[model samples]
Target: MTDWTPDIVAARFAEAAETARRLPPAKVQGYFNVWPTLLRMAPEQKPNDDERHFPPTPAAVERMLEAMRWMQMLDVDSRHIVWMRADHFEWSQIAKRAGSTVRTVQRRRNMALSQLTENLNEMRVVAASCK
Candidate 1:
C-alpha cells in the first residue's frame, strides 16, 4: 500500500456543514382536554441557558449530534494540519495559532495527519469498490 497524505482525504473525510441538519425539538402534548387558560401564553423573556429551554432531545439524536461535533473537530484539526504543511509556512506562525511551542505544534500536526491517515485509506477502499 502507498502512503496516504492529508490532501487526498481532506475533502472526502470531512462532512460538509451544509449537509448537517439540526434535530427538531421534542413534541410536547397537553396533559388533558381541559387545561388552565392562564398557562397557554408563551413566555416573553428569553430562555435562560442554564435550563432545558427546549423539549428533551432524544438519546440517539443527542449521541449523533455529539458524534458529529467530534468529527467536525477532527476535520478541522486534520485540514488545518494539511494546510499548514502544504503551505510550507514557518513554524513560528503555526505555533502562534496553536498557542504552543514550535516543537509541540509540530508534534500535534504529525499526530493529526497520522490519525487522518486511516480515514484516507477507508475512503480509497470505498471509492475503489464503487468503480
Candidate 2:
C-alpha cells in the first residue's frame, strides 16, 4: 500500500465526487405516469448536443466507496467541511455555512484531512505487519 497523505486523501474525495456524478440517478418507486403516450408531445432529440456520460470504472467506484467509508471516521461537521471542499465549494461559502471564519474553516478541514491520513497510514502499517 502507498503511504497516505492529506493531499492524496483530498484527491480521493474529489474523485469520489466525480464518480458519484457519473452514476445513474436513483429512481423513486411507486411513481407512475398515467398520461397516454399519444397525448404527450415528444421532445426534440439533439443528437449532436447529447450530454451522455459514461459510468465510472469499477476501480473508481471502489475508491469512491473507500473514501466514503473514511468519512465515518470524522465528526459530522468535519465530514460536511471535507465533502464541501471536495465538491469545489469556496472557502468563504463553507465558512458561511459553518458559521465560522474562513481561517477556522480551512484549519478544521486541514485537521480532518490530517486525521484521516494518519488513520490510513496506520492501517497500512498494521496490514504490512500481518503479511
Candidate 3:
C-alpha cells in the first residue's frame, strides 16, 4: 500500500485551500441587472500590479472535493484548526480564535494531520485489496 504521511496530508490541505481560492465567486440566484446596457457605467479596470487569478482545473477541483470529504473524519475543533493552518493563518491567530496558546494550537494541528494520514493510508490499503 502507498504510505500516506502527515506531511503529504498537510500538503493536500494546502492545495485544497489554493483550489478553493481559485474558484469563482458565488452569486445569489435570480439576481438580474435591471439597468439598461446603454446607460451602464464602464467596468473599473484593476491595477496592473494585481496578479491575475485563473480557475482551478477539473483535476484540482476533484482533489479539493476529496480533501473536503476527508475533513469529515475530524472533530469540529480539529477541522477548524487544520483548515486555519491550511489557509495559512499564523499559530498566534489560530490560538487567539481558539482561546488557547500557540503551542496548543500547533499540537492540535499536528494531531489532526496525523489522524488524516493514518485514515488515508488505511483507505489506500483497503482499495488495493478490493482490486
Enumerate clash totals for all models, in the order shown: 0, 0, 0
Please report the TM-score between candidate 2 and the true structure. 0.81
Name the lDDT value of residue 69 in candidate 1: 45
Better of 1 and 2 by TM-score: 2
Q: Write the per-residue lDDT of candidate 1 for residues 1-131, one digit (tens) a residue.
A: 56577544333233222122233334567644354323223455335433323323465455444434435546565556545644556878888876788898777766765676676577669988999
lDDT by candidate, in order shown: 0.53, 0.89, 0.87
TM-score of each: 0.40, 0.81, 0.82
**lDDT of candidate 3 over 1-131, digit per residue (tens):** 35989988899999999999889678899886665423222365446423446669999999999999999999999999999899999889999988899999999989989888988888888898999
lDDT of 2 by residue, 44-93 (tens): 65563344466689999999999999999999999999999998999999
Rank candidates by lDDT, best first. Answer: 2, 3, 1
Task: Predict model 2's lDDT versus the native.
Answer: 0.89
Which residue ranges in model 1 land beyond 4 Å of their true spot? 1-73
Better of 1 and 3 by lDDT: 3
Candidates 1 and 3 compared: the better one by TM-score is 3
